[model samples]
Target: MGQMRLDTDPIVQVDRKPKCCFFFFSPKIQANRIVRAQLWVHLRPTEEATTVFLQISRLTPVTDGGRHIRIRSLKIDVNAGATSWQSIDVKQVLAVWLRQPETNWGIEINAFDAKGNDLAVTSVEAGEDGLLPFMEVKISEGPKRIRRDSGLDCDENSSESRCCRYPLTVDFEDFGWDWIIAPKRYKANYCSGECDFMHLQKYPHTHLVNKANPRGTAGPCCTPTKMSPINMLYFNGKEQIIYGKIPSMVVDRCGCS
Candidate 1:
């Protein structure tokens, strides 16, 4: 129905050697409209990336570890302004994801050169039209499903009498922001250093863990200097989203049981 923007840090030279950005989005299907399945956005590369890997994946639950399955990917040589505005063809993947219930999906933007590693940072600003990442979708009419189906229009251009429905839908996010986290643990890994392996502040690892061997317990962490209650309260960083009520334990491992 509208656009959703997700932003990250501005610093490219993080404490970690390689700068990796993990972005997540959950698209919920609408009642009557058909999804066009395309994502358009502007990607600003802070530096030249001789070779880059842009991967889109889904997180699936596992017994011991949490991991993401690669759904779509791209490798290319990037110039600073060459790919500012690009369109990703996601028709096939969007259709598949829409069929399932709320699923975890993400974009991993990693850049490097033929010789080896490279550096880059996404331009994330605080306001709309800032460097924050965003996406847009188009909707058309469907067959069999009618106007009364989900109270939304499948085809804005059509006034058809008969419509159809199959279970195709998407959601940007579903509930689960009710609970709050103490600022201490969050500030500890403010830059998200090596803490991607643990569940802190009663929350799952904010990053997508390795599917083959997701770390089971919390590890020693360091809080950031900006640990304040007010700062933590207004922070809109979304790590994990739960479909129903907050789970008993911070998402016991990353994949579905």
Candidate 2:
């Protein structure tokens, strides 16, 4: 999984009566590689009983002067809380900014429908490190390569055992990790058995090393040589739901040292 965090003090538009906070982020990652993206903001505690609606908007230049037009507003409900963090889905919005860099003016957040209630928000300039507004992005190069379990299967009880890959299913539910929303279980697989000089052709370097010091050198042991990832959707420690790929979760191949 890949993550990026950004923080900047937003420019407040005093002209607009309603409070408007603008945040700018530069995502250096490729547009097509982004699998998931989220915008996180910390909302200060409020005593008001009415729910405040936060409107997230994208800014697009409309005139030669320093003016922009807001498009595609994403409204999020802000409930009265005790300094809590809120997450907003920004995958499509971020993709547009990456594809068209010129249109990446930034995002605007405004509070509405609170009568006269004051919506206090934390910013990078005035808030603590943990309370600052930021973003988390998950990126993937392309389609994942599926690798099958190949090679000989051996029994540990047998005396003529050799290096091999064996089945090992990991049950998340059995482990009491209910936070994982998908894939209650998966094939993790394991490597075991032994490594002998008879299969030295598979690892030429190890063969050469053992050949040079045949008297005292130790032989290679069975181990996993390649691994693959698994896509997971789980709740983080902050209780935020996330969907990302966990790398090296599956053993793909087994070989001698």
lDDT of 1 by residue, 215-241 (tens): 643343422222112122112334221
- lDDT tens per residue, model 2, 77-120: 55565555556778887787778778665666544546744343
Candidate 1 lDDT score at position 107: 39
Model 1: CA > 4 A from native: 1-35, 40-49, 62-64, 80-83, 105-129, 142-257
Give, for candidate 2, the lowest lDDT window spanning 10 residues: 13-22
Q: CA lDDT, every prediction?
A: 0.36, 0.64
Per-residue lDDT of 234 in model 2: 62
Residue 45 shift from truth in candidate 2, angstroms? 1.3
